[model samples]
Target: MSVKSIVAIVVSLIILVAGVSSVYVVDEREQAIVVKFGEPKRTVTTPGLHFKIPVMEQVIFLEKRILSLDVPPQEVLASDQRRILVDSFARYRIADPLKRYQAARTEVGAARLLEDAMESTVRQVLAKEPMNEIVSGQRAELMKKISDLTNQRALTFGLEVVDVRLKRVDLPRENSEAIFRRMETERQREAAEKRASGQRDAVKIRAAADRQVAEILAEAERQSQTIRGEADGQAVKIFADAYGRDEDFFEFYRTMQAYRKSLGKDDTRLVLSPDSEFFKLFMDNK
Candidate 1:
């Protein structure tokens, strides 16, 4: 090959490299800014082939679509003086490419900036709200306040906030455990009071039942004694009437009853003359 041919080929390759470097493509999902000598020249949001000074100008591409940022859990103090842990997130977009580039050169850096803003804004707004409102149904209202405040802070970074929300809000671990213990103690005390009341009522009922039983037994005993006395008096009157009706027959019957009782057992023994007065009835009958 000739020396002139080699020089011409080298020049052609250099021109091709320069031409390629001067042209850059912009994606539909991104917007860009051209900076010449560290100074922003123009902002381009159109997606197409673009041109810039090959060696002195640079293009910075930024996301044109909305972006999401998940913030880490942060511990904050509420207006009610309670400590709470919060997990949150925000949706945003790069509204001004030049401003975004001036604030932070890359998306990752911009994200960090936004995160700090969100953290600060969340703390500021949540600190003014009570713990119950932050954790209960009123959380939506508080989140709106936080989002509005964070949007104000985002404007400084050339970012537009779409929405901000708290994903989870809860009491600290120690606080929750303490509340559980207190509730348990309260329930135990209530249970003990109920048991004591039941036992007192049981005692009263038993005492009343015992008194009723004693009264019933005393009445039954008195009635039984009265009936026995009446029965004994009637028997004595019948015996007297029988004796008056036949004196000799009653005497004979009494002597027969006395003899039966005295000799009723096998061990009975008696000594008397066979013709004595005690045997007069027996001798006459024979």
Candidate 2:
């Protein structure tokens, strides 16, 4: 080969290598950190082709996408000396790549630091709370406090904590069993008391109803007796007036009615004189 051609080929090869090393494509969801000899030089936030010194500068790409970190279940003791298991998660983003790179070189390291800070915050917050507050009802407030504290701690690391949430807060298995048993016992006792109260109310209502019914029946009976007595008195007065007009006929009629009522189908014998007043009805035709 000619000397000029050899020189041109070597220059072309060097240019190709430098071009390959200098050019970097920043993705839409990523930010690039330009570092010269392990020291941060600049940060590129825009997405496009970027350039740097061919041999000395390096580009470190960081994800700009929202991230989630799940903290493992941790046991914490409350102010009441009750142990609880808490499982939680966090959402965050990288706001400053330079600070993030300086503090946490890798995503793993950032996550670890966040976890440690979360653990400390959880312990500190829970240590002043009662068991019930930790296990129920106050989870939202606790999560907010954790997120705030975590955000404050992560500020130096260029991390923005968006949210922190507790998946579950529960008593240990043995404690849970005890609490369940107590709840069951309380419910049963309340049910029994309510049942007893219902029975008492039922008895009182029945007694009141019965008293009203008895009073109604007694009042009806008294009115019926009064009406019957008035009728009897009117009948007696009518009979007395009739008898006064015809004494002989009324006496004969009364004697006949008495004989009919006194005799029975099973009677074997009846004795009476032919001319007696009691036999007058039977002897009248004869």
Candidate 3:
């Protein structure tokens, strides 16, 4: 080969290598940290083709996506000296790539730092709360406090904590069993009381109803007797008035009825004058 041609080929090869090394593409969901010899140079937030000094600088890409870290369950003692198992989780985002690279340098390292800070914050906050507050209604407030404290500490490491939440707060197995037994006992007692109260109420209502029924029947019987007595009196007065209009006929009829009622087949003998008043009826009939 000619000397001029050899020189042109070598320059072309060097130019190709340098061109290949100078350009990099940052993805849409990623941020790049430019480091020169173990020292951060600049951070690139925009996503596009970027330029760097060939072979002299390095580009470190970090995910800008939201992240979730599930903290393992830990036993915490509350202010009431109650031991509880607390399982929590957190959400975070990488806000500053350069700061994140300097502090943690990897996602795993950042997660570990977050876990440590969360553990401390949880312990410090929960240690002041009562067991009931930790397990029941005050969980949201406590989680907010933990998130605020963790975020304040994590700012230096370029992590923005969005929220912290507790998955569960459980008592130990033995304590849980005891609580359940107590709850069951209380429920049974309440149920028994309710049943007894219902029975008493039913008995009272039934007795009242029975008394009312008896009073009604008694009133009905009294009214019936009064009506029957009034009817009998009115009938007797009517019969007396009717019989007064025909005294002679009434006397004759009464005499005949009395004879018929007193006479019997077994009475064979009698002593009486033929013209006596007692024989008047028989003589008239003959």
Candidate 4:
């Protein structure tokens, strides 16, 4: 090859390299900022092929999709003066690429800065509430407060904090054990109180039932005695009426009944005169 031909080939390669370097494609999931000589030239959020000065401009890619950062567990004191471990995380996006590039040059740097911002916001917001409030249904409200505060603080960093969440808020092991013991004691005491109350109610019910049974039985016995007395009086009236109707026949019948009652067995003997009224019937029968 001739020297002129070699020079032409070198120029073609350089142009190709420069053209390739000048054109950078930004995908739908990414945002980019062009920096010229360590200064931000322009930020491109739309996804397309973009051109820049080959050697002077450099492209910095940032995530346009929502990103997640899991915060490490942090020990914090609650408003109630109780110490707890909080594990939290957040979701964010780069809202302003130029500002984000100026504040944090890379995605890792942005994440680090956001972690600090979110942690600070969590501490600030949670320090005003007790552990119970943080763990209760009001936890969503508390998280919203933290998220709003973080978003406000992250505005300068060009980050839009989408959500802040607490994965776990737990007492220290030592404190949890102590609380469990106290809860157990309280439950046992409540159970004992309930049992005592139930026993007292049972005794009252039993006493009432016994009293009612005794009253019922006494009333029944009194009614039975009254009926028996009325029957005895009726029997006496009937005997008197029969006796008034036939006095001689009734006397004879009564005498015969007495004799039979007195002399029913052979072992029975009476020392009475043969002409006695008691033996008159026997004599007449004989």
Candidate 5:
């Protein structure tokens, strides 16, 4: 091969390598920083293809989108001297890539600092509030206070504190157990009171029912007695009418009734002569 052709080919290869190395693409979700010897020169917030000095400058990409930091759960004491477990987290995005690289050097380092600040601020702010406020009364207010304080510290790390929240707030094991016992005792006392009230109501109902039964029986007896007296009076009137209509026939009917009454029983007996008054009527008939 000719020397001129060899030189041209070598130049083409070098240009290709330089072009490929100089060109870098920035993603939509990311930002880039131009660095030399670990020192940041400038930040590129826009996305798409970009150019850099080949073999002279390096590009460091940082997340442009919001990031999350899960602060480790820690036990904190409230202002009221109550201890609770707080699980919290934060959302943030790097506002200044140059500042972020200078302070934290990496995303992981930034997150660590932010988490530490969040945990510290949580303790500091929450410890000035009561347990009720921390748990529910002013939970949002307390978290906001923590977020503001943490953001103040996060400035050093070049991170913005978007939101801070507590996922759960709960009492200690011993407190929970004691509360449960007290609740159980309260429920048992309520049940006993209800049972006593029910028994009292039952006694009242039973007494009322018994009184009504006695009153009904008395009324039924009164009605029965009134009817019986009326029937007896009517029968007596019928007998008197028959007697007044015919004297001899009435006497005969009375005698027959007496005979029936005396002899109706199968074991009836009488030790008397044939001329006894009971048989006088028979003799007269004969």
Candidate 6:
């Protein structure tokens, strides 16, 4: 090849390289800023082919997509003076490319600043509420406050805060253990009190039952004694009438009853003279 042909070919390649470097494309998911000599010149949000001065102007592409950031868990103090472990996250987007580039050189840098803002905002907002509120249904309100504050702060970095969420909010391990133990102790105490009350009620019921049984038995015995006394009186009247009708027969009948009573048992024995009055009736019969 000729030397002139080689020189012309080299110049054409250099021109092509410079032209390609001067033009850059921005896509739907990207926003860009053109910086000349380390100074941002213009911000471009429209997605299309763009131009810049080769070797002097540089295009910094910033993501237009919603970015997610997970913040580290932090121990924060609640208004109730309770310590809580809170882990959170947020979604954001680059609203102004030029401001974003000027404020943070890279996405990583922006994320760091946003994370700090998120932590500070969350802590401040939570500090105004008690732990119960933060852990309960009212937590949604507190999170909104944090999100608003974070959005306001994020505006300075040309970032739009979309949403801030609490991934997990709970008591520290030590606090959790202490609370659980206390709850268990309280339940146990309540159970013991209930058992004692039941025992007292049972004792009262048993005593009442025993008293009722004793009254019933005493009344029954009184009725039985009354009936027996009435029978004895009736028997004595009949005996008097019989004795008036036939004194000798009645005397024999009474003596026979006495003999039966005396010898009712097989072991019966008596020491008496054959002519004794106790045996007079028996000797006459014999």
TM-scores of the candidates in the order shown: 0.77, 0.74, 0.67, 0.80, 0.75, 0.86
Q: Write the per-residue lDDT of candidate 3 for residues 186-227, one digit (tens) a residue.
A: 999999999999999999999999999999999999999999
lDDT of 6: 0.92
The digit string of per-residue lDDT tens for model 4 on 1-286 reads 9999999999999999999999999999999999999899899999999999999999989989999999998888889999988999999999999889999887889889999988888889889999899877599999999999999988889999999899999998898999999999999999999999999999999999999999999999999999999999999898899899999888898998897899899999889888987777667563
RMSD to native, candidate 3: 5.5
Please give the range of 10 consecutive residues that has the lowest summed lDDT in model 3: 261-270
Residue 226 deviation, candidate 2, in Å? Answer: 4.5
Q: Lowest lDDT 10-mer window, candidate 6?
A: 277-286
Q: Residue by residue across 98-147, what tens digits does model 1's lDDT show?
A: 88889998889999999999999999998998888888858878888889
User: What lDDT is reached at residue 165 by model 2?
Assistant: 87
lDDT by candidate, in order shown: 0.92, 0.90, 0.91, 0.92, 0.90, 0.92
* Candidate 5 local lDDT, 1-286, one digit each (tens): 9999999999999999999999999999999999977777888989999998898889999998999999888999999988898889999889878888888877788898888889889889988889888888988788889889998998876788899989999988887899899999999999999999999999999999999999999999999999999999999999999999998899889999998998999999988898887776778573
| Candidate 2 lDDT by residue in tens digits, 1-286 | 9999999999999999999999999999999899999999999999999899998999999999989999999999999999998888899999889999999999999889888888888888888899887776587888888899989998789888999988888888898899999999999999999999999999999999999999999999999999999999999999999999999999987887787776745664668677886776666574
User: For all the candidates, what are their Cα RMSDs to the real structure?
Assistant: 4.0, 4.0, 5.5, 3.5, 4.1, 2.6
lDDT of 3 at 264: 50
**Model 5, runs deviating above 4 Å:** 1-26, 34-39, 47-59, 76-84, 123-149
- Model 5 Cα RMSD, Å? 4.1
TM-score for candidate 1: 0.77
Q: State in Å the error of residue 245, model 6.
A: 5.5
- Cα lDDT tens digits, model 6, 239-264, are 99999999999999989999999989
Candidate 2: where is the Cα deviation over 4 Å? 2-8, 36-42, 46-48, 53-56, 73-87, 126-144, 165-178, 212-233, 262-268, 281-286
Which whole-number lDDT from 0 to 100 does residue 132 have in model 3? 86
